[model samples]
Target: MAHIPAHSDPARQGAPTTSSRYELLTLGDELLLGLTANAHLTWIGAQLGRRGVQLQRNVTVTDEADAIAAQFRESWARADVVITTGGLGPTCDDRTREVLAAVLGQKLVFDPRTEEAIRARFAKFQRVPTANNLKQAYRFERGEVLPNANGTAPGLWVEQEGKLLIMLPGPPNELQPMFTEQVIPRLAARGKLSDQEAYIQIRSIGIGESALETMFECTFSRSPGLGIAFCAHQGQVDCRISSPDGRYGMEKLRAIASECAALLGDNLLCFGHDSIAQVVADQLKQQGRTLAVAEASTGGMLANAFADLCGACKFFQGGIVSTSNEAKMLMLECPECLLKQHGAVSPECAVAMASGVAEKLGADYGLAITGFSGPCTGGGENPLGSIYIGLHSPHGDWAKQLTYPGPRAAVKQRAINDAIDWLRREVLKETHRIAAPQVN
Candidate 1:
């Protein structure tokens, strides 16, 4: 927690302003129905945050002309700047240009440059331009065309009555670079922001939102300009802080976060963006430590997840898919006596499996995941989705039991997420944990 800074004093607000905050409207039915993810929003947010411009609000609508027009009109009143994505194409469904022109009370005018660019792009693709494609040249009065190097839908930047409207293609590849190179510089030139800011994100595991919130109550609201927000998903929490006018606010936030984390302690996970496995791998790479894994119900999923991350080969010693009791005995040297006595899903088997992999692979650290992912299971005490994760380090060996409710795939996914989360928490520095307020 740190002192969150207030918006500069109103008296000081009269000073030079660098940028005007805008409302973002993303238009498309695919977004609402989850057919297409709204990655454009995330990309723009990150890009703008880097430039000290805060996107105040976001609204999403389908490509219907009336609906789009209504939202644009409403947003215009509240926001001096509005950016619309999608519905700028030539298809009949792409009515963004028409709706926006209507909202501005202007007639659609054709631009020669836009038409030429569309023609040239089509020529590059070796296709004849249809009459429908001519719609790409449409523009409103005093509107400027934003060339799309990646696509035919050139973006539009229009100015009217001291308000600015920008329309960009919906595809992320086109939208991101165009905004950065063309739009961001223009907005920066307008002087909406006073100073730049620095941000650091801390990734944590084994901590729930409420617990983190309650513990950091004292420090949470302490800063005037600094901010700390907890973004939680799939049992992992990201604590992020951003501040303008330098690191004073950032440092304070980090200090308070550290203290609160120290109180809450280990299993808090990594402090930065890297995962537990990543942190471990980095440490292993630096210290020359090797690793291995023996998995059962997880079916080598953990190893697969690690593989997705780059630089894994530097420290990942190997992994064993010991799905069957026979594989466990033959590959990892898990004794039959242990399996029969304690069973596959038991803590004893998990520990033995980790140790077996470590010794068999001759690695410094060994990890094992043994669980019952099933519709039914043999163990009378253990039902479906009963899991145990094992960790074997030079110091000692440990195992934890986790019972989650879900279908087979969901349970497995949760197990893997939890496993990675726990690993991250264990390796990171201990910090006080914040516990959020409880509801009755």
Candidate 2:
């Protein structure tokens, strides 16, 4: 893995570089409790990444004035621009205005424009504005008020003490549009017009991080102006390539990455940003086939993965989650005799589940996942992480056994990915076999 690009290399050596990069500070007590999500920072960072600006550091603080001021000071000291979301409301806990005033040696004065807007909003809701709501109009020295399309609380943009500060409301509906329309263009104008780095990610499965790293160690080390990163999980790996060449950019980078992946052979799964489910969905589209799923131990995850794919309704015929033996027999029409004899975790049971789903749904193919995804025992005292995935086609039904090593949730997730990968491979193989010459 490579370090964050902005932090590793200084834009210019020694001299003070012009205002270019930014630091994001998200303020809310909910973030600390893991209740309120911090989506603004991620959204802004992604947007900035598309441009040339880089977000150096991110800090999350409660609505406390002291904590917000301390973080604001620290962030601005390192970054030329600072962006904050949350704590802009008129509630007693909202202290963003006071903190910004303290940091910039200014006082918050009531603005008539903000006050009228707040009052109008409350009137539309058939309510009277409270005294606390008057704080919404507070503004700092020479600060510009950015309109909020979706909310009453306006965003603030201030430049002082050789640093740029921007504050927006917490709600995504307000934050996203305001940041795009009001903040981004201003930042671009203030910063230098440097060529942006291109980013490309190659998603793969059934390959370990160490092996993937070794496969490209030499190539990445020698590749000029390219940054490569590998993110590994239980069932998947992502190879991220970022190059600092604006011209021919991602196109050129993707071509090189495809060549590197080809070197790794079949270990390379999907190209670009497609997940395993997305890749499988693409295969179904190409073959003009629809798929249905029968999930057991993996719950509905296998089916849910396909449903989450974009335009899934085009080829996914839905699925059934036979969580219990009764559901399997009743809903999916799995043979009660087979379940009693072979057990639900057995490959035979998985085969029946897949075939039953395919026949019932009238889909071209069906995928089923069954096994012990827990601390429970399976056939012949087989320990946890024992899983079976079956694929049923018009020709026949076949199942594959997988033994993954991880926690209960990890095991289930791994099984789901493995099941999808198996179906993907089968689709490729079946297509190739059908296209092959028959030696009659």
Candidate 3:
């Protein structure tokens, strides 16, 4: 796999010959102190990347003119383009106008056209313009003014000594539209558009990142253009494959995804960003089946996944949280003898709970999660992180024992995820065997 480092990537390189090289600098005190997130950087980077202008660095500076000037100068010398957001408003701390003028060695001049536009904008709103609003009309003589249709502050586009600089408004409503309509056309005219790179993420559950790396180690080396990365969260692994060909090189991307899926087999959850619940929801929708859940140590976590989904009432019948042995017997109709012989967290009790819930709710399928998610053990053959997930269907009822070492929150989540994935797999398997959605 070709994993291009940022320093070596042509898009990030500062070579004068590299057409798409760009750096982003955002100016604001709000961003510096985490008062607000720097949304401009993310939006600009994504937009520019699609147009072949890849951002090498993203910098945030306070509303000080010196700080803005220093970053602008650095980007001017180092990169082909520099795009900045914020510090262009009509406030005392809004210093981008003067900073740009200083950086370009030009005097700030009040433009008649800009003033006319700003005054016209205020006039339309039936509001008198403040003296500070006229400050928005000032522009450095070296740059082109891109009018903001949504606000008073106009965006600036500057080209000097082979370096490109653009200053957009701080507000997203104004900046986003201006950048897309006004700035992108200008950027496109500068040079050849960048060759697109594509990314495909195959998410899986019940798998470790390290184990996946080892499994795909040989494939990564053999696949010339495919770039593989594994990110582990909760109990799921997000295996991302990027290709130099826009969107993982099309056919190659699909082939690589298929190969990876085969490697992961039953563990593979689904493609793209769909969560386990979504995968199960889709499968249930296709199968035309209803599901009910009973959760013990997981509380209503297992049921909540389905509940949160849109139109969950169609397929999700009901749920019960049998946290205590008494509740397990009373609510879920779990046998007293079963709870006495095996604790609530045991496989036998888990299976009974699952089957019992299915019978109670009159649903086609039932899912149950029982676990010891805690710092202390809950008196069982299992330890602190041991869990038993049960699935009940007309054809079969079974339970599996799983153990994970983590804090209480993590163990509960993992156990719930295990139950969901197992049900999804079973549903998919049934789909393959029959034409219509059938249980057993």
Candidate 4:
């Protein structure tokens, strides 16, 4: 048995600094093969960050016994706490259970309480527990059980030589509640956290990565305990900051955020974790306004985004996918001659679409997106990834033309993000204003 020490300093007071390290290990062939998005990593990272725990490394391995055991040993050596997800199911490839037994020099013993919980869960579904289900009742020797109210799998928490190893089920519903209920209390009691860490995400649009990095040159260079990272996608940059001490960190975050807000000006969409769609919906809700959309190049993605939110049906009004010029002319009331003159991907066409949809749907505002998202289609001279977005509101009709160089899916996302930014500016009515497009 490899010996590891348990938490040495469980009792500390007044948020005095104590260093605590963390590592995440995900076990599943599906994760290694990239069959499904690793949703757990982001959720776990955010959850721990809120509690001042910084996960240093995230490792993913297939369901191979040797590979799993090796990662376990390496992670335990480096970090005080290690969290593993997946490989706990009843299937044959579930290797976490046996590997833990081998590495810890212990045997898996059936725990009757776990069996009772599993049986009770099955009873609710009007089914009997099969013999195979008993495998879930087994726990590592001297391990504590994490009851899962949502599922049959019970999580395991173990400690040796002072280090903590928590094995959680892969499914979010099971893992989330268990961690919240059983794991958080134990972790908070560790008293291993060095300084109370503070994390904040500042989301902005219309700023390039190089520009943001250059602006923060001295800021990042000087702060030793402060960590900073930037993620750019769909025409926005997410600026993340981590500070060691909570009070001092929050003060620094506020000052730096104020400077960023001033520098980015209208380009800054929001501070914190709000999505562009959510921001737009919040503004619309505040103003008690409504919206409708007409999409061609982007399909109905704009509509779908609004639909994802609650109370959308009340304010979203409706939308039309006028893919063909005939629908644009007949359904949206755009003049046929305009389609012939400017083509579907032109700013003039976008304006017409927006203006027509707003009138057709009897909405306060209308948005239209048109573009060539991919390589030239049907031998047209229009450049690929050229997008034009139009907005018609009580004030006036406006359009913005941007040439984004990316693949098909990326172009559509950029268009949607830009459109959302336009909405944000209109609702706020401060900062830089998008000029109305010229109508022929």
- Counting clashing residue pairs in each candidate, in order, gives 44, 0, 1, 11
- For candidate 3, lDDT tens digit of each residue in 225-306? 5656787887899886765444333455556777778888778787766678988887888778989999888878888999
Could you give the C-alpha RMSD of every candidate to the true structure, in order shown?
7.6, 5.7, 7.9, 7.7
Best by lDDT: 3
- Candidate 3 weakest lDDT stretch, 10 residues: 1-10
Candidate 2 residue-wise lDDT, 31-137, digit = tens: 98899778777788777755545577888998888899888888888877888999988888988988888888887878898888888888988999989888888
- Error of model 1, residue 201, in angstroms: 5.3
Best by TM-score: 4
Give the 10-residue window scoring lowest on summed lDDT in candidate 4.
1-10
Q: Could you tell me the lDDT of residue 363 within candidate 1?
A: 81
Give every collision pair in model 2.
none
Instruction: Score residue 180 of candidate 1 by CA lDDT.
Output: 81
TM-score for model 4? 0.82
Q: Residue by residue across 1-440, what tens digits does model 1's lDDT show?
A: 22223333322221123347678999999999999999878877766655456688999998788899898999998887898899988898999998889878888898999889888988997998999989989888778888899888989999998989999989888888888889988887777444443355566567788777776676756756555678887676777665554435444555655766675555455564556567666656765667788889988788887776688887787789988899999998889999999888889998999899999989878888898888666377677889998888776788999998878888888888876655544433221222345569
**Winner by lDDT between candidate 2 and candidate 1:** 2
Q: Stretches of candidate 4 above 4 Å error?
A: 1-18, 116-130, 177-182, 189-197, 218-227, 241-249, 310-315, 326-337, 360-362, 375-381, 430-440
Error of 4 at 81 (Å): 1.4
> Each model's TM-score?
0.72, 0.80, 0.61, 0.82
* CA lDDT for candidate 3: 0.80
Global lDDT scores for all candidate models = 0.76, 0.79, 0.80, 0.79
